[model samples]
Target: MKQFISALMDAHLPAPDGLQDGMAHTAGRRFDVYRNNVVHSLITALKVGFPTVTRLLGPENMNRVAGAFLRAHPPTDPRMMYYGAAFPAFLESHKQLDQMGYLADVARLELAIRQAYHAGDAPAMPSEHLAEIPPEALLQTKVHLAPAVQVIRSDWPVLDIWNDAQTAQSKAQDVLITRPAFDPIPQALPPGGATWILALMQGAKLGDALDAATTEAPQFDMGGPLTLLLLGGALVSLE
Candidate 1:
């Protein structure tokens, strides 16, 4: 099985050497056909998985990259949704893409959005609950982000690039993904917003997260992110 899979991914490798005449009839034409179909499917999966990367690199270039990517990282799960999770790192390490350093972050942004979109549904914390928390206790309380909430920190304008690769400004940007309903929405985070989110994710109390955020960026306001958290159904609970 190992030999078959190895040969299937590499065209240069023969089809599980020492095959019977019936299977290897016509110099393994049958296996060749099978291999081509598998490779094509995998490449197509990759293109669909990383559409942003595909468009930036162009179809031809994407195909070449995807081919190499498939050989380096093959699918472990039969589910297509789980494929290409490591594509961002692959792009970052790719010697040819040294000039396009932002590609990896862009891919990470897209991947996060996709993952959030597919995440299981969870009820949003009621606004009344947030309002009920006493001012003094609110800061000491911890908030629970919903299953569909995802955050990504990047050193490039990843959200902008994802929205419009051609004209996106070359500036560092962070991203916040939230699924208020059926579709996941991706937006740029304000200064220190990502830091606050990360702190919350790490189990920090609201006050701690705020202190951390404000210390990093004096102007980091809690109103905006809190509004998004409520409106976007990001906070599932608080404890």
Candidate 2:
């Protein structure tokens, strides 16, 4: 069964030897149709999973890329939504897509959004919880972010490139993804924002994360990213 299924997925492979339709010798036309349908379904799933990649490559080019990706990385999980986790890395290594270095980052953003959408739900910590902390205690506090929160740091203006698609306005940008309500939203992060959020995500104390952010970005400010995270309900708890 595995060998037959594998052959079905690979166009180069001939229909499994002795494969037949209703005991008749393998029907080339029927086999071709079945193969095409399976390929088409996989491509369609890729298109839906990576809409930004599809928009960037267009339908025809995306189909080609999807076909190659499908062959190289077949779905291992039953859930089709989780199938394209490696596509961003695939794009990075693809020779044909060398010109679009930013495409991989864009795909990563989309993948993060999809993962956020499907993430397990958890109750958000009250925004006032931060206000309740004393200034001295705040430094020692370790924050917990919601499971759906994701930060993507890119050398290229990934969020801008994603939003505009045609013209990228900046050279570099960081993105913060959060699912505050029913849908997930990806917002462009201000300078030092991703650094700070990522540090916090790793279970660093506030003081440590702040120091890391300041070191990473000399002009780092805690206000903006803090507000964004609070408003997005991304803070789940603090220890």
Candidate 3:
């Protein structure tokens, strides 16, 4: 019975032959309507989930792209909230969007923001806690980051494109996504900021993370990243 119902939902089979009742006769049509509604709703949810991506692509283009995406990748999970996990990868492979090289990265950034918002919460370690750590141990220590912190790095100016689309007055910018409370917020980052934040989020010691950042971006500023992490609740605890 479950397999039959699944087939009906997927429009794989016709209604079981010859049912006398009018309601039973309409079952196929009803199922088709229901299926359409489900797809529509999921597509709408995807739009909401990746507003920045949608804004970058524009409405009509996004809708068409999303429709193609829906056909290529059907939802496997019951949870609709995380349905678009493959969207960035899908965008990357799409032939039409090849001209816009940064679209895939932008989609990734948008997806990361959604994940961060839904991530489990943990109280951040107080700034004083870092001070209490012995100087010698600081370099070897591993720190935990808040569940809401996510760092994304892309060669294209994805952060700048996102900011330009989102705000009227802001100049082109690179960004770090963080959720200090419940909502994810975008923070403009310095040249090597993403690499630095990625290390911190991965539990690297402060010094090691800084060194990684500097290696990648010689102009990376320690003060800026430190201040951003501390204020944004990215630092959870030091061990």
Question: lDDT tens string, model 3, 61-145?
Answer: 9888887787678789988778899999999999989998888888888888889889998887889997888888877877787
TM-score of 1: 0.92
Ten-residue stretch with the least lDDT total in model 1: 18-27
> Per-prediction TM-score, please?
0.92, 0.94, 0.82
As for lDDT, the candidate ahead, 2 or 3, is 2
Clashes of each: 0, 0, 1
Give the winner by lDDT: 1 or 2: 2
Q: Write the per-residue lDDT of candidate 2 for residues 16-120, one digit (tens) a residue.
A: 776677868676666778789889999999999999889989999999999999999988897998989989999999998999999999999999999999988
Worst 10 residues of 3 by lDDT: 165-174
Global lDDT of model 2: 0.89
Which parts of model 1 have CA positions greater than 4 angstroms off? 17-24, 165-170
RMSD, one per candidate, in order: 2.0, 1.7, 3.6
Worst 10 residues of 2 by lDDT: 23-32
